[model samples]
Target: MQAQTMQAQTMQHKRCMATVNKSRSMMRTYLSDEGVPLSYSRKRRIAMNLLKEYIREKYSSNEEIQEKLLETLSVYFNQVDNILQKTESPIEKTMAIELLNLIKSDSELGEIGFVDLEPQKTIKLNNRNKYYVADFLITWKPTVSVNGVERKLIVECDGHDFHEKTKEQVKKGKLRDRKLFLEGYTVFHFTGSEIYEDVSGCAIEVLEMIRSWHLSWVHG
Candidate 1:
């Protein structure tokens, strides 16, 4: 009986060790990806913390549980990668990372299901070969049907130097907004200063918009 109990304990230890190794491997792979900018180390740390918290909450010392958790971690990593790859500029990238973390961490904001987040989405202009690339195109889970289509949102981070310096750029931006509106997307534009100065406030405003949409869907 003593020998049998010792063997069981040894097996459990091995399973736990395997889980730790698998988690570490996943983290390393995720961090090493080129899509993740080196400047976004804080975001990386948050991702790691979230992963660890998830594992702690959901898994035990069981090997099977660890395997399942690892699968979930893969999904999480994919989601993060998708968001990170949406922007190349430092300010935009920072804002995206901050907004993503806010959404993931906040219970109220996290409830809004995001179906797809495409960075640099290309849309052809009406009956023309010309196309415009949106900075971020987010497809939310069907809250309300807008003309039989799920509602979508566009997030544009504008830099002062490029977007505000030229009247032509401003005119083009307005045209782009009109085009997106025609395509049934609600647009939100945040300047570099606004994003850098008050990220949390910006996130709150976004949450309010989502909440309003959700409420409309539920009521209507």
Candidate 2:
């Protein structure tokens, strides 16, 4: 879809919009170079409110037209996630690419929703500057009703080179998991084998948990 709205906002940022379009056509998605996202609310976790707005408006009555919108978004995020792999453990690196492929390579997932996948992203403490680099940061869009929100989650991939771990490391892992939980993030841990065996199953498990949490938010 041609992101014609972006051109009117800032002339200097016009090139940012072009990245979303195909090489043949100069189209782009909602991400831009402003460096500051359009804010909405806490529940609406989407960084670019414009994208969500476009989705809602079009979904409202099926009358809005953003030609090739889905195709446009498909090309929105382009990055070399392997940049962080240099510092990651072998299993960590593997999980990173697998999860990225699981989302990007899935056409059905693309049609119903979009995801923001950032490797080595920092998650700050709820009220403190202290933060940790998450293995993978994921946020799924097109959130539906259920306490009126669809929360984000954290997936941690653990690797034991010799299938053994020190007690100290185990303690620290639990501490970090609890801290993430306290910060309102659903923390999940998968062994190298578990994720490698069937990343799709691992992903499906995560999605199911998110849905369960949404329902519990409203009913519990």
Candidate 3:
């Protein structure tokens, strides 16, 4: 009877494993679809976590499974990186990389400043068919304050060809800025020329703004 019970349990486990694999395959197909309405990074992270939990449950004793999972994850990450690379201009991308590196490398500044690039913020237009994308979004938390004061910042790295090429483009940019300001985001614009000329200086300016806000929160 014990041997029969063990065999039954084994059969049930195999069935469960098959179901899990089928579910994972379906999830991968959904995530890989371009029309899934999720950012590449977000989708990649979700897929990675799903795989991680599945491996932990089913492949805890198997090194080969772990290796294969890592290989698959690497491919997903490369695809996401390629998508991001194609989305930005060379100069703007360089500036963003430099600024992020500078912010992360600073001990104190890094503690308070959290940065995300090309994060989507959906604003409903009157026509209900339009929205704006902010270049960078930063969340600043003041460490010295017990009152939990924070700031949401939008940083726009404007390219000359795209943002300021014509009067109408410039006007549209201002309108977008006003809309964001109305929505309670502190928007700062940095031209590509300024970023290229002094990337560190631009970072310093942003850091200074964060510091000022922190001090205000601390004293108030």
Candidate 4:
């Protein structure tokens, strides 16, 4: 079983490398012709141009349809997951359980927990055009960061199944966390003991950490 898991991970690595090569090739193609690497914003601007043209032509008669299409595109291009979409996850249950704990400890922390149904992470990896799921992905209101991008808090419950026990595992975990950090995500790892001892305290710690981080851009 361990062998199979290793094999699967190897295959995933190969596929990811292939994708990265393909992306780099495309970028080189544009750079060779246009003398500039096709940046993400430029690509999105071109896509928006094409999409707007298509919508204008396709829905020429219905201004309402055009308006809606533009609205959808605007939202999609600008943001990621909608936190208020009634998501259910471990954090939601924790919120319920910790609801009372925080109230007893601190009124501010009490409002966090499961009330904010932290959805799975939506990671944009350089090698893969996919989202890597985290246990919980929370966006605090007043979410924008110093770089004008939305900040996110990724809560990971580390267990034997998903955490580092070996040296290689530790390296892999750190690389993953570094990638997440590069993309404006703050990651917090909690052991079973921590969560078991004080569920509300853990939740409150995450809330406060993220809150302090958000405030730091302006205040700090």
Over 4 Å off in model 4, which ranges? Answer: 1-116, 126-130, 143-149, 217-220
lDDT of 3 at 181: 74
Give the per-residue lDDT digits (tens) of candidate 3, residues 42-159. 8767777776776667667866656665565456446445434644654455455444544544557756544343433444545447777666666776555545456777777788
Q: What lDDT tens digits, residue by residue, belong to model 4 across residues 1-220?
A: 9999999879855543443333333322332232345643575566567667766776688687567657755664343224313224433333322422232234343343222434555667776675677767666544332345345778777656545699998898898899888777888888756765666578778667755755664474
Lowest summed lDDT across 10 adjacent residues in model 2 is found at 24-33
lDDT of 2 by residue, 88-174 (tens): 665565555445545544445555444676766788888777878777777765434334354678877776772329898788878
Candidate order, TM-score descending: 1, 3, 2, 4
What value does the lDDT take at residue 31 in candidate 1?
Answer: 52
In order, candidate lDDTs are: 0.65, 0.54, 0.62, 0.55
Each prediction's TM-score against the native? Answer: 0.62, 0.51, 0.53, 0.45
Clashes of each: 0, 2, 0, 1
lDDT of 1 by residue, 105-216 (tens): 4545445544455777887777668887777776666533355546677877787754556899789889878877887888999887887677557756776777677667
lDDT for model 4: 0.55
The candidate scoring highest on lDDT is 1
